[model samples]
Target: MAERDTTGAEGAGTEAPPDRKRMRSAARLGAVQALYQMEMTGATLKGAEVEFESRWLGAEIEGEQYHAADVKFFRRLLRAAVDRQAEIDQLTDAALVERWPLGRIDPTLRALFRAAGAELLALPTPPKVAINEFVEVAKAFFDAGKEARFVNGVLDHVARAAKPAAFPA
Candidate 1:
């Protein structure tokens, strides 16, 4: 369900390269933020999706442009995350330690994991791809903090569990 935009806003003139795969990556990041918003504000799934489409997509904050995301992928991530939050959370809990459960994690990181878990569970992309994308998203938020490593580990664990065939014996 990937769509291509010939608008060239993604690459512009120079500097940033064309978004061959980055659009989906952007969608993942955006979906995580949208999911976080829903979690914190108790927003409905449809409401969150609309807000993203109307206000955030292609909208700017400063001077820089926001990358055009894969809207279909975003919807998939958000919908799957919303529908399977409890199951995803249970997997996250299982991946965590006894004391430091998912609730103790930062809310944003929790949202990131939830979106990542949804993608992993949905089977659209390879688990490694989804895990790597979320890990990069973690680094973007925390700048190589412990959270990034935590995300990598937990995501790898979840991926291994959810798609065991992806991992070798």
Candidate 2:
């Protein structure tokens, strides 16, 4: 995987444990994968939760190490994203080109928007922080590709709408 935690931007308060950061990062990635899996496989939210929660999350696999994810956070992001996917998609849809609606976007990008939207819309963290984190997640999957820039722009636009109070005059 990609080294995603060294962007030099910290969250709302003091730094979390090194382990905590790793786990949250991992959970973000896993949440994207779970959401993608759900869309592609037609799996229910509960089914995706069970599959990811049981077999992966913290498990080391294919000789790679996985930090133990923040299970509660993972569950919350997954569940909340599923519950408000329509809203998330609507918000993301507003940010995309009229000809390239959310439905026309890549499945992975769709999942990224939904997963990041869940947090950006509801989580207590700063919007910039959420944007940065998701940008990193995008980088992890896209490897500095064009998708990463698209993710940044669309998400930043969504954040301005989702949490206008978080922005300044």
lDDT of each: 0.83, 0.84
Off by over 4 Å in 1: 1-20
Q: Once model 1 is optimally superposed onto the true structure by TM-score, how far is the C-alpha of residue 114 displaced, in angstroms?
A: 0.5
> Which parts of model 2 are misplaced by more than 4 Å?
1-13
Candidate 2, number of clashes: 0
lDDT of prediction 2: 0.84
What is the alpha-carbon lDDT for the whole of candidate 1? 0.83
Q: Which candidate is the best by TM-score?
A: 2
Tens-digit lDDT track for model 1 on 102-133?
99989999999899999888745777778878
In model 2, the worst 10-residue window by lDDT is 3-12
Sliding window of 10 residues with minimal summed lDDT for model 1: 7-16
